[model samples]
Each structure stands twice: as structure tokens, then as C-alpha cells.
Target: MKTFCNQEHQDQAVEAIKSLVAIPSVCNEDANDGTPFGADIQHALEHSLELCKQLGLETYIDPEGYYGYADYGEGEEMVGVIGHVDVVPAGDLRLWNSGPFEPVVKDGKLYGRGSQDDKGPTIAALYALKAVIDSGAVFNRKIRFIFATDEETLWRGMAQYTKKERIPELGFVPDSEFPLVFGEKGLLQLHINGTGSNTLNLSCGDAFNVVPGGAVYEGSRASELKSALDELKFEAKIDGQKVEVSGKSVHASLADQGINAIVRLAMGLLKIGEDHPMLHFLAEAVGLDGYGKNIFNGVLEDDVSGKMTVNAGMLNIDTNSSQLSVDIRIPVKISKDDVVAQITTVAKEYGLTYEEFDYVASSYVSLDAEPSITLLNVYQDLTGDTKNKPITSGGATLARTMPNFVAFGMVFPGESKTEHQANEFMVIKDMAKAMEIYAHAIYRLCCNQK
Candidate 1:
């Protein structure tokens, strides 16, 4: 494939990313605007469809505002390029150097909420398809670009699309890192419900896929809680009855690296004699163990996807009931039913019931698979680096929504990951490079197919 991507395309790609980032497309369930995701996400979807239409592709948005798609070329077999528009909430605005929704460029990196996690790479993939079409490449198969709106939450939007539309024979999601991901761990989001204490009322956390950075507790004993937190050496601040604990935020997939403020708050509360079922569940049953070693009685790990990790994403405690939202990444070899059984047994001990609300089955595409082998050849030919072979990820992507799909490109090796964190950014240079890769990969997969 010729170098159809140029500075013009890169500039356009950056502009597109900024335009979408400017809109805070975090899911707003209370909008009452008839849009399933909210008004902002509706606007983002409209904007994305407009961009695709500008490239002379046929685009369609679900009338109910669930999902959107753009199509180019015409053939029986379709090549799908999947991505999402919605982003995680911007937690602790004080942590950002600039406004989270305000898009800006400094030090050659574009800073914004959705710049790295998905919007940047999504737009990059769009422009890559543009490059191929602009080059007048002959196509052997139709290409479809699927824009999912609810990827960060429960993927309800994608679920609607699949139920109503045709499933592509094969596809790749541009939501993860490069050289390419062939295997992904199973994603399980659970809500543990139990009884709560009348005295201790606490609630915090943003999303299940994000490691909460800060959790606040407001109750009768402020001074005691502060002392307990200090004794535990946790970073926190207390004012009267309100106490806020601080932790580093990262994606839930990398929960081992993040300091969960919710977990910290529970540990501190327990130290100060706060008796609550959820608190004990968080403090004793979970604590800082990402692998659920204490709760499961052993480490749940496999050679295929490393270890099974867990994150206490959200917590709410009141007089009547309590709910703790947990995000778990199960190893590929582990059965979801088996994992759920273990969790159910342990949760009952703490007076809690394990209820899995969302689940994505683990996915593994062999390196020798048709699209996998072809995509790898494209990467090796372009960058000439074979050291980083196909790998597995703890994070779930749209690729796992269907069979014959894998996640490809956007974040490179040795790059700092800022997804689902404050001040999230994507290196402009690296994004432009990803666009070129997408273009060539698409050409080989759809246009230059034998």
C-alpha cells in the first residue's frame, strides 16, 4: 500500500479528536432527553456521523440513539472497524493541569478526556479509511465502521446494534494498544448487595471500569476516623464530619497499580470501630488484594492471561441496604460460572449476595488465524519490529462482543497509559503513526485481499 496518509490527514485527525473531546460525552442516565446515553452523547454521535459522511461514506445512526455506523465499498464479506465514543467520568478535577473536557495541545500531546482511551484512536481509524478511499484503492470487500456509544458502561448500545443489525464476519477494535491484541480476559461486573449500618452512611466511586481515586466518608466520628487514617498512613483530608481519602486512579484493568480510595476508606473506617457489613467486606474480604486471594482462598491465575484481578469500583452504604460494585478480570482458562460460584459462596459469609450485572466472555484469536496473521504482517512491514508479539490483555474491548475479532493499534509499546484517568492524553505523533497503520491494515484486509 502506498503512503496515502499525509500531514493533511494528521491535522484533520487531531481537529476531529478535539471537536469530539470538547463535548463531555460521559453517560447521563438522567437527561430525560429520550436519548439512551444522554444529550451530549447524542451530539457526539451526530458529529461522528457527519465526519464519516464528509468522507463520502454512507452513515446511519440508530433512531433511538443507541449506536451508529458508516459503510464504504460493496461486497458480501465486510471488514469491521469498531470503536466507542463515550468516555469515563473525569474524577477529581483538581488533579488535572487543565480542564478535563477542554481540549488542548502541549508538549506534542493532546490532552482531553477521550483523547487516548478511544476517541483519538477511533478518529484515527476513520481517517485511515479516508486515506484508502482517497487513494482510489480497489476493494474486494465492504468496510464498516461501528461507533459504539456505551462501551465504558454496560455496552447496552452495542447490544442493541447487534440485535438489530448484521454482524460483520470479522473486525478489529482500535480501542487498545499496538502491536495488536489477540486475546482478552473475561470481564465481569458484579454488584454485591448486603445490609448496612444505621450509623455509617457512605457512598463514592465513578464507574466499574475505573479505579476510584477519591472516596469521602461523612459520619458522627470525624476526629476518630482521621486519626485512624493517619495511623494507617493513608493520604486523606478531614474537615469536621467529612473525611476524604486520596488514591492514584488508573484503568480497572490495571487495578494492581492503582490505590483504590474506596478500599482505603473502608480500611480506615474499620480501624476506627465503624461496624458495617459493606465496610468489613471491603476492609477484610477485599483490602488491597487485586487477585482476591483472601476472598477466594487462593490466587486465581493462568498462563494465558496472567492473573485474575479485581477492583472495588463503587460503594454505597445506608441504613437499610448496601451495594458494592466490583469489576473482575477472570483469566482466560477460568470458567465464568466457576468464578461466580466462588464469589457467591464468599459473599454470603459477609451477608452479601454476588450478582453479576455485566459480563464479556474471554476472547482468544490465534496468531495463525487469518486476520491475525494478515494484520501482523502489515505491522511488521510498516514498523519492522517483531519483538512484541501478539499478547493478551486484562481489559475488555468491543472486539469480544462477537467472534472473529481482535483489538489493534493506537497505544504503542513503552507508552504511558492515561485512559480513565485525569488529564488523559494521546501523543500526536504516535496517533498519526497509528492512522498510517490502520490505513495499510485496512487496505490489506479489504482492498488488497487475494
Candidate 2:
């Protein structure tokens, strides 16, 4: 845990993160650009690769713009530092004190979308590596910094990288909380399609991984809906024939912490005696209970990774069709098929067709394993917190993209979690601390070996 990160390095890291945050790199599936993710994301990948090259690493950008990586040192064993450039859409721009892509520093916090979720930590890792490299640290194994393109959505970009590149023997993903993540729950995103109401047409949410902060209803029932919402003491705005409900936003994996506006709107609609398959599904089957206990009779729990969580992140209803986008985090020991079967059964009762969208299987690394033990030791040594040991998470990371990989650092314990929410930020001091932790961990994993 010797210090190699200094004030200059911290300043540089912050600048780099701000540069990335300035890019609105939300994934666009329909851009005419040949890039798999879209033009903005491709720009992010190119920018990150140039940063790596400037740091004296051999950089490679995927010809198809699916992924990029920078390599240093050389050996039979390659150690990976996995990260993603793409971020979730910045929903409801009006909610932000500043533009989601306009990076700003105030009161020692960097504010922007992707500031905490990934771009900040990813750049911090790069600077941490830069610190180690600048110190002339000996490399016993090659280190690869993988820049993935499609992490906020499906991991198709990482899939492409894995399909073509050499897999790392051991690595760590800097996309989770410290001291280290020993286990990650399986991430399941799917849609339930069903019959729609002839009179109701509504849409809410933007991503399967984000809890919708606002839901709008634009129809003749706006007045009735507003009255019902007022009766229920729900926060909402009504203008003419449109009503919008407001709720707290957080990552879908931690849906329990968020107040889903879509769910609130559904309750309001149901209270007004308005009926639709998606509305009933939301109000009855998946109310505010994040664990979805009613849907499965509380069968989705485990001691290892705790309870299973569910988030109805999106709701869409039209004259002819309706669909509910759901994000579920299954405990490590739970079978995804079992979870799917239970949800499918419930969907059948509502005459909704369940369709799977994307799934990332759970990943676990024993606390005693090589990189896990090494990383935890580095963190405890640097921070002197033995009480905070390795823990499991509901959030998925690039750790699942490789064998012997686990998520470590970037978010410290007892900090406000603000990754996917509006006004997302990363504390400046935390970024410096994380860079030091990553530097020490990377050195232990990749350097000073025979």
C-alpha cells in the first residue's frame, strides 16, 4: 500500500473523468453509424483509447467499435482491468442541477451522469495504473485495460471481446463497492407483453437497469388520475390532460431504495378504475415490494446473496399492445430458470407473455482465492478496516466476463449511493483513495513476481 498516487495524479484523474463525463455516450441502437452501440459510445471508446495511448500503453480499438483495450508488460499470464465506457441514459434532464453530460465540480464532488457508476472509476483505474507505471514497477505479467462498449445494456460488446481476444487469467473490475466483492447476484432483464387497453396509452422508464424516476399519463383521465394521486398522497404534476408522478431513482439492483414513479402511476390509474394489463400487473403483482415476495411467495431468498429483488423498470401500454420491462437480481444460489418460471407463471395469469431480454449469470470468487485475498489485503492495509470484509452485491459487473475475476473498489462503505440517480456524483477525495487502492491491488496482482 505504499503511496505512488499524489496530488498531481489525483488532479489528472479528475480531469480525465470530467472529459469522459462530457460525452453523452448513452447507447443508441438505431444510429446509422456502423458502430455497434452508436456514434457517441464509439466516440467514448476512441477517447479512452487515446488516453491509454497517451499514458504509454499499446492501445487497440476494435475495428467494429465493439470494444477496446490497452496493454502493457508481457507474459504468458495476462491480468485484466475491465471497465465500460457506455452509461445508462440520463433520464429526465430537468431533474439535474446541471446537464447530465456537463461535468461540474462543486463542494468536492464531480457531478454528471456516469461520474460514479463507471467512467470516473475507470479513469481512476487508468491513472492508478499510470502511477504504478510511472514508478517503474516491475511487471511479472501483462496487464490489459479493457474498455467495453455496452455495459449499461446487454454485455454484447464484452461478448465480442471475449469471442476474439485472449482471456485474462485473473482480474478485478473497478465497478463496485470496497473492500472487495466476493460474489455477485445473477442479473435478469425481461419483458412481459400482454393485451392493451383501447383507451390507455402510456410509457415510462428508459432502461431496464434503472428505476424510473417519473411516469406520465396523457389521456382524458388526467383529472381523475390527479385526484386519485392526491388522495393517495403521491407526488405528481398535472397540466391539462397530462399527469406526471414523481419518485426516487436508484439502480434497479437496489430497487428497494427507490420509489418507482411507474408503480405510483399504476396505483393512481387503478384507483381511478382504469384497467389495462400492464397497469394491473404493476399495481397487483409488483407494487412497491422490491423483493417481489407476492409474486413468488417469498421463495427467492438465499443466505449467501440475501433476498431476490425485482424492479418493474419500464411500463408501456398502447391501443393494441402492452409491455412491462422487469429487472430481477437473483441470489447467487438461486436458479435463473426457477425465477423465470415463477415470473412466467404469474405473467400467464395476467395473460402476459414473458420474454427474456438479457441475463448475466452470478459470479463468485472465494475470499481465500488469489486475487480476492490479495485485493482485500491491499484494501485493509491501506484503509485499516478489517471489520469490512468481502461481501456479495446485487449489481452486475464486468467481473462476470472473465474467469477468476471479481469486482473491487470505487465506492467506499457508508457513502451515499448515487450511481444511476439524478445529480449522480463521485466525491473527489474518494476518487483519489480508490486510485491508491487500485494501484496497490494491481501491483500486488501484476507486479513484483519472479
Candidate 3:
């Protein structure tokens, strides 16, 4: 592991992360042959696979571009390291000190969109495997590094890969924090639809998993809404018959930390008229709290993953119809069906139709389990940080897509989380340390004699 951690490999890992980040592999809704997530995403995947080949690993890309994998060693039982190259869209570029796609290192931190969320960690894991291979370690099982392009959006790439490829017996995803994550809350995306008037046009948010930073509403109550915005101290302007409100954007998983512009605009409109369907929908159904207490009677909490979180991530309204896109992270013990049923009943009461567009079940890997204990021990031994125990997260990672998988770190304890935020970055030194940790974890999990 020390040999693999040489300055040369660390430098290579940093360079790889920068190259991948420069691609701007944001997933697009448009789909075509060999480019299910658009051409740029495909190019990113191909570039990464080519890098794997250059490292002397056997690599394969799915014909339809759903996913790709770089393999090391040869055996029946496989150890999977799942990660994604796709990154969330860079929001509000003006907030960044550097271009989101132009990777740069300043003050010892690499600044870019996917620097911490995944691209940096993915490269770290690759070099870790390279280290293991270069060390000439004996392997009890093959190691496969699975790369998916749709993780930021739908996870359709992983879904397609699992159907056509082999599932690993045990593995971990390097897309979370260092202490290790044992449980992840279930993810549910609900679309609340209804017809509305008063507001002729409205729009906010590009993705259902991001807290909207700004929104525009054109209606009869523009002046009133502007006054409300001023009273609320929200940045806003009134132009003709439209009002535009600006707020801070953060990941939907950490919705509490952000000021949702869509929610604020809806609140302002409610001051004008409570009967407006769109306004009432946002006020009564969505509410201000990230928790879904106002809408579902707050019946969604558990000991493992704590309380559920709801984010009104996307909203749109016109003269004829309105649609509100809501993203929920449900507790592990809560049943998705039960939560959806409660939301349906409440949505109907507001004269809106409830439709769940995407769902991924909660995942829990026992702390006492072999894979869990093994990875935890590795982190504790390497970092000398034993105070932080295995934890649960509201964020979903590729770990939940396969059996016996959990999310291990690239994020260190107490580090500021920049994922899905403007001007995201990863500490260069931390990334190099992650490479060494990942290398040791891989050797222990895949190579050490039983």
C-alpha cells in the first residue's frame, strides 16, 4: 500500500480527477444510441474507461452506454467498487471563484463541480486498485470498479448494469464519508399535479434533487408578492406583472441548509390570496419545514435513519395546470407504500393528483457484518479517528443498488460538504490520503490471506 502511495501515483490521481471534472459530465434528459445520458456523459465514461485500459486493467463499456466497468484480477467471487462519473449541474456560476468545469487547485483545494461528490473519489479508488496490482498482491477474488453515468439523475445506468452483469458478493461505494455509512434512507420522488389560475406562468428548479435557488412568477398579484418578498427580506424584483425571487441553492438531501426560492415565492403568493391552488399547494402541502409534518401527519421516523426529509425541488404553474416535484428521503423503517398513500390522500384534498415517478428502497448493512467491520477497521486504523462510529445518511449512493454494499469515504469527518453546491471542491491532500486509505481497504478486502 505504501508503494502505491508514492508521490507519483498521488500526482496521477490528482491529474485524473481534474481531467474528468473538465468534461462536465452532467446527465441530460435526451437519449440516443450509445448515449442514454447525452453525448457528453458518454464521452466522460469513454475517457475514464480508456484511462483504466492505460493502467493495464481489463475494461468494458456497455454497448448502449448505460454503464462501464474496469476489472482487475480473475476469479469467480468478485468485490465491487461502484462509483459514478456524472455530476449535478453547476448552479449559479456567478457564485464560483473558478469555472465549474475548469478544474483548478488553489489554497490546496481542487475546485470543480464533481471534485468531492464522486469524480475525485472514483479516481482515488482507481489508483488504489492500481496500487494493489503494482504491489503484486494475491487476490482471493476479482475486483471490479463499476462506473455509472446516471447516478446524479435516475440511476438508470446502474439499473441496466445489474440486469446484464454479475452482482458482487460484497463491496463498498467510495462516494460518501470516511467513517463509513451503514444505512441510507429510501428515496421517493412524487409529482403533485393540479389545475391552477391567478398565476399565468411560473417556473423554478432544473432537477428534482436540488433546492431551487431562484424562481419567476407572472400573475395578477405581482405587486403584492413583491411587497411580501421585501417584508420577508428575500432578494426579489417586480417587473411588469412578474416577480423574481432569489435564494441559496443546496442539495435536496440537505434541504434544511438552503432557502428554496420556489417555496418562498409560493409563500409570498399565499399572502396575496390563500385560495390560489398553486399558492395553497405550496403553503399547506409542502410547508416550510423540510420534514413532511404538515402534509402527512409526520408519521415517518425511525431509530436507524432518523426523521424523513421532504424537498419541494421543482415547481411549475400555468393557466391550465400546475405540477410540483417533491423529493422525499424516508426513514429506513417506514414503508414506501404507506408514505405514498398518506401523501396521496393529502394531495387529493388539495385538488392535486399524486404520482410517484421514482423510488429506491432503503439500505442497511449491519455494523457487525464482515464488510462493515472490515472497512470500519481500515478507516479507524489509518486515520486514528475512532470517535466517529458508523452512521446513517439521508443521501442515496450506488451502495444501495447491490446486495452487501455500503458507502465508504472520500469525505472526511467534520469536512465541509460541497456536493451539489456551487464551487464544489475537494482538498488535494485529503484526496491523496483517500487514495492510500482506499488502496489499503482494497488490499485487505480483496488480497489478504484468510
TM-score of each: 0.98, 0.98, 0.95
Q: Weakest 10 consecutive residues, lDDT, candidate 2? A: 291-300
* Model 1 CA deviation exceeding 4 Å by range: none
Backbone clash count for every predicted candidate, in the order shown: 0, 0, 1
| lDDT (10s digit) by residue, model 1, range 49-131 | 99999989999999999999999997789989888999999988989999989999999999999999799999999999998
- Please say which candidate is ahead in TM-score: 1 or 3: 1
For model 3, where is the 10-residue window of minimal lDDT?
270-279
Candidate 2 shows a clash count of: 0
Runs in model 3 deviating more than 4 A are: 1-3, 31-34, 218-223, 237-242
- Give the whole-model CA lDDT for all candidates, comma-separated: 0.90, 0.91, 0.86
- The residue pairs found clashing in candidate 1 are none
Cα deviation at 247, candidate 3, in Å, is 2.6
Q: Report the lDDT tens digits of candidate 3 across residue range 1-450.
A: 154577788888899989999998898766554478888889899999999999998999999889999988766788999989999888777778999999999999999999998999999899888877888888888899999999988899999999999999999999999799999999999899998665357777878888888888876778888998898787998898888889777778777777888888888877766466656878777776778688877646898988888899888777778899999998899898888888888888877889888999999999998689889988888889999888999899999999899999989999988888888999988888888888888888888746
lDDT of 2 by residue, 226-257 (tens): 99999999999999999999998899889888
* Alpha-carbon RMSD to native, per candidate: 1.2, 1.0, 1.9
lDDT of 1: 0.90
Question: Which stretches of candidate 2 lie above 4 Å from their native place?
Answer: none
What's the lDDT for residue 444 in model 2? Answer: 83
Strongest candidate by TM-score = 2
Of models 1 and 2, which has the larger lDDT? 2
